[model samples]
Target: MSPRKPDADVPPGLLLVDKAPGMTSHDVVARARRVLSVRKVGHAGTLDPMATGLLILGVGAATRLLGLVGGHDKTYEATIRLGQTTVTDDREGETLTTTSAAGIDDDAVRAALAAQTGPLQQVPSSVSAVKVAGRRSYDRVRAGETVELAPRSVTVHRLEVRGITRPTPDLVDVDVTVDCTAGTYIRAIARDAGAALGVGGHLTALRRTASGPFDVTRAAPVEEAAAALAAGGGPGVLPLTEAAATVFPVRAVSTEEATALAYGQRITATGIAGPHAAVDPAGRLVALVEDAGATARVAVGFPPAS
Candidate 1:
């Protein structure tokens, strides 16, 4: 595919991608950049190559909104294998240790998972993308450096066990669905669960089910998205006006107000605790506004009429 020259006319919006397994999150962004012909494509969250499911990308000016998008809670379905631990806390990593899981029972598994639910501290995997001293932990690991990440608070709102299977006499696979706040790691959950049960554990599979307002059911396949855009059916980007309206509190403004706000003017606040979408009477988003006492000021403005 030919790279699209940077154009000011491309519409800004989000793309919900059903990422295929074995492709890194950056791979999808690179493909979207080529397919949509837009240079600015950013994703809200990262999914490891071994995982599949919903991945949200922002195109063009929507890249400015990715930080907000990334703040939303996420849901995942994963299989945790008890009996072995890995360097990465997932199947893709090298196995570091193994222990018999034959003596573990369902009741104990449920109890351990239940204990992990709600607010608690979690240590990310050693090979996670988290930065330490301005460098990625994974990069540090690959360079043969020892890395220890500090624990941070995370909330796992709900954890439901879907099923359990004994693939072998000494190995048990627990399938679970998790709803968690942003930054929660499913791999870490598997690792911790196994440690709690005195058996080493690692993630075998992971599939994200949802991220805030976006769900896997509504996501288009990455290949389909690329094909549709390349065929000129559309950029396949979700409309920005609808996206902003749905994701944030809305404040209707007149064309005059819209124009003023787009030019960095502040309008009267309506007591809405903002980051509210200030929309024109026609329902197009003019700016993201926040209330400050008597007025609302633009947090981000889409100029030239998006």
Candidate 2:
């Protein structure tokens, strides 16, 4: 690992966490702070407490990269209960209504899911984290107010019905896999699908499988991550060099060019796209650069000497 700057405290990089159920995303960050023993820690995306799976976190300097990471598409596996509606659109919320899904056939379920695939305008659930009047919609709902949220554009690239199970005449459980753009709400899809079929619906389970380039497969268990950090060992951050190369385009720079870029000087674009990583010969990240036609400008620089 490269040596930290004298003024640096904790190492800077990304940490991939496989979040456990019943833990909020902020709770994960709190645990990370305790383990890593540094105050600077931030997650790229928010995962609901009822949801579990991959969560990408940026520690120290890596925090700057989180905004870029959050925009990527995501994949999720979920269970939709096609018999009931909930205030929160998920199992965690109080049941608002119930209807028999006994007559709904596989064809009906397929047709409903098919309608939700592709581009559409979706109204997020009232009990969602979406900001309304600078307050969370969920918070407003909890305070006994009915929140009607505006519909937003979201894309569901793919929706595959994994399985269908009938535990009772009135209840149907549909397991599904979803690949969607950021800002999509799977719970809303469930709610809408059930509503369309004349049976209210809500999400029963949700597990994120992938977020951008990071997947649950590569994520460290939260407990294990904390233990590693508490032991005064590495916090399992994705190395800065690897993170930059994997998430963006790459440009190799000689030591001299790396120094120039670090010192805020522009270099010739190597025909690579703008916002590419400029790596030193030693494979360390030098900075993030953007192509300015004739010259490359520094977006963010990491001076090797520092």
Candidate 3:
């Protein structure tokens, strides 16, 4: 049976979970619902059971904000172990093969990583949640069906090499900071990087450094997140308005503009062009809008606005 609710006194919002290794992202969400005692819960993105890092969770009405969360860029710090291949594209898989990447120099390795540092196409690891023909890739893998996910374009703003360690003549660890679009798979980066170096590689450690404005600094471990809620503690998981404010291009809305949006009407273009975040005089975020049809129309809304 699942655990009972405990944080009955806490207000609902997002929880930045610094997920520990070995627990599935779903496990974290389940634990969080019990810890926060919220009737509604959801996770913004899925992290593999073996990987750990910042996992954003929505409590109560914040669940509606998941799609919004998806729009923001994400960052990660990961360690890829070179000279080996894995069925899972990660260390959790069976060791498929091994080779000595001993001759690969730091310059060549950096060049390989740098080659992937900009906007490029990326393929997800086979053992992933991506769906094909309306079925999850992992589900197919579980049922003994061969799965191959096609490459998709993803923007990689940065791929800073943090370090590299050679534990053995064959085993090497490369650390990287990834600032990229939402769908880029770090595991794929590892796989491709290894392929480039003439040696296979797989991810051994993963830590999401940031998602939009939320960083590791805002994240807490499962226990700590629970304790904070249980103690009648912590800040409102950045209300919808505030959370939206962090990413959207800012716009100021007049009373007329606010009224139009409040009544589900689009406002006229006041020579202000944007796919912008419109905030009321009260600091409540009103809508995300695009300058279309000669008016700044609401592309998305945030009412009960923060």
Candidate 4:
């Protein structure tokens, strides 16, 4: 059969992509736009060019949901190399210093990493995507400007040391799985841990395993998804209603309530929780709503696609 042509009928939805290394989050979105034939593609969170794994993308009107999705907790599998410090705090950066880490025992390594858990005021890597003085910190760094970013509050729910290996007498590599609130920097964790151990450190490898309720296991490789779309198959998108239900608490509403929400009017409070997905009898997502006194107000409304 011939491939499906891009048309207005493409549904608003979400795509779970298993991103490959060397592609930025924006690159994935651009590929999605070309294959899905819609210009409304947007990503929930960013994965660095050197990191790979689950990347959530919103399509069509679902772009409005990205903000909420980006704030959720995430999980990563990473390898931290003790004894090496780098400009970017990752292997992609130029080496700054190297110290002998052979003397650091597994117990000491665990202790240092344990200190990184719970609440933290982490200073992001100098090359992070964080904005500084209205420009990206990375951009400033590439321009030879020394940028000092203030520490930001973040939570590391868990840090499991998967294994510890000595690749050389001078270096130690620690494999770990991290569950952290949004904005927690794994690179910073490595840097801080190495600092505590009296050695330097940097991230060598990283991959996102999960984000919020979404897991990498459900993701399709970007190439595979795009190829399917180009071949006139389904874009493999999770419909907006299903996606919303997965991300937020569901509040089933009557047809009348759906109409009111679609019309920008408030409805009776669900009381289930604020930021719940309000769905109609037919299961179409009406809006993401929050309770205000006796009524629920739309945080983000999804009017029926015209």
Candidate 5:
């Protein structure tokens, strides 16, 4: 047998994927592992099988950074159906109840949605991936475990109703754009809005629009990644330094400072409060630096000569 090439020692970087609906998050990672040809692949957040849109995967050393990004804010475009309740809080679940939403005029819909725009305590869907005493809530529920998730503080930075349609007295479909914190369930938003209006609710469709600065437009499908890798071009993975420069505050370091970092030493200071990306003379992202008390050194290590 041919010797297998070693998995990359250094984390490669982030691959922004435009995940298609119908596959679990783990499935995306498995495909990425083949295309990127590295075992250190990981993703920042989970998207439901029925939801499509941007998914950010970390390659190599970038896996270490997933935890940081996972907890950041996210955005979505979702369709909420009022006048119906579902077992999973979404269209895929069995219908549990239905109430005619004919009395819910647009003015009342707007008011209820507006009330939830800022910070709110939200109860997650019972079938969520959240853990209950070490078991996945979804798993427990499927096994006949009654699930009840408590309310948590979550911020909805923005929620805009794009359009509303009521094709039947028993169904009210509202398309909305939502920018919210991580762990905020859009399904719950639909469910609660209906409950608030004495109707019923569940999410019918969902598409993640953005996560942090990453968005759907920049996401590459697994097929695209595979084609890129097949020609030896590699999966257009974003180099950490370049990715950092694109995403973080750019601090131009002097020749001396860059050299100090390249050599594992510290320069006086960039005079810039960081969590900042530092670039070399060639415009190569070298490190992410912060002022840790007295010295300015690398907080994230990007191999200097690679």
Candidate 6:
């Protein structure tokens, strides 16, 4: 085997990409690596090939922050088609059933979706990226194995009906905006809501509008950003310190405290409720710290870039 390439020269930062439809989350990461010439790129979360929206890419040392970043709440705009159920719970999959939704009125749709709002147990789609028995659910499904996923606790903070339109006599398309906690599946929402109304449903479209403090509006188009990078212009990356501050509470530490934390020593309590970004006197991120009783301990530390 060839020797592994070193990523020591790659700058650590985050890139917010407005992913176009038909590209998987991994596809965007691959493109970033090629364009930015960085080998340590990874995405915080994955988006289906059929879905489009904001995708966060972490480069170099910033990859360490992705786990916490992926835990944040997310918002999405989706179009659910009532009357058709698909094997994957989305339009990309084979149609499993079709029932006329002519009798399903607007109020019925609204009420059914409203009922799905709040804390609930959600079964992820059988063809989801969720892992089962050490392999992806989708991989198992593709191998002709029946996949049954267990229900997970997820919260749907809001489900707003944007519009309801009938493209055909038997099919109704409902546009909705969902604000949900991490891991909430919008596809399952459509499926359950349609089942409640005596019809079947599947997602026709999905676009993530927001993830925590990052939004689609602030994301740069993937190709555009890549082109800029190739041309020696800005890569549109948010530097590490700024990205950390945007996602977590900020705690400015004294020079002495920064040194101690850098050496893996505990400092005084931050008084912050949760994990916070501790920045050195020079405004560089030193570590993510949380109070352990009366003292703050480093959850993750970033040694100064040499």
What is the lDDT of every predicted structure here? 0.87, 0.87, 0.80, 0.89, 0.81, 0.89
Reference-based TM-score of each model: 0.94, 0.93, 0.83, 0.93, 0.89, 0.94
For 170-229, candidate 2 gives per-residue lDDT tens digits of 999999999999999999999999999999999999999999888888778766764554
The alpha-carbon lDDT assigned to residue 262 of candidate 5 equals 75
Provide the lDDT at 302 for model 5. Answer: 65
Residues forming the 10-long window of minimal summed lDDT in candidate 1: 228-237
Query: Which of the two, 5 or 6, has more TM-score?
Result: 6
Residue pair clashes in candidate 3: none
Q: Model 5 over residues 1-306: C-alpha lDDT tens digits?
A: 999898644445677788898989999999978765678778888998989988888776667567766877899999999899999999889999989999899888878887778899998898999999999999999999899988999999999999999989767899899999998999999989988988889999999978887777877786575345434344445666666765678888877777778777876666678577878778877677887667777787566544
Off by over 4 Å in 6: 1-5, 226-236
Q: Model 2 lDDT vs. the true structure?
A: 0.87
Q: Let me know the TM-score candidate 2 reaches against the reference structure.
A: 0.93
Candidates in order: C-alpha RMSD to true structure: 2.5, 4.0, 3.7, 3.5, 2.8, 2.0
For 81-165, candidate 1 gives per-residue lDDT tens digits of: 9999999999999999999999999899888888889997999998999999999999999999999999999999999999999
- Where does candidate 1 stray beyond 4 Å? 1-4, 226-236
- For model 1 the local lDDT of residue 197 reads 95
Instruction: Note the residue pairs that clash in candidate 1.
Output: none
lDDT comparison, 1 vs 4, better candidate = 4
Error of 5 at 26 (Å): 1.0
Spell out the clash pairs found in candidate 4.
none
Better of 5 and 6 by lDDT: 6
Clashing pairs in 2: none
For TM-score, candidate 1 versus 5, the one ahead is 1
Backbone clashes, each candidate:
0, 0, 0, 0, 2, 0
Model 3 segments beyond 4 Å from truth? Answer: 1-12, 226-236, 249-260, 267-271, 274-298, 302-306
After TM-score superposition, the amount by which residue 21's alpha carbon in candidate 3 deviates from its true location, in angstroms, is 1.3
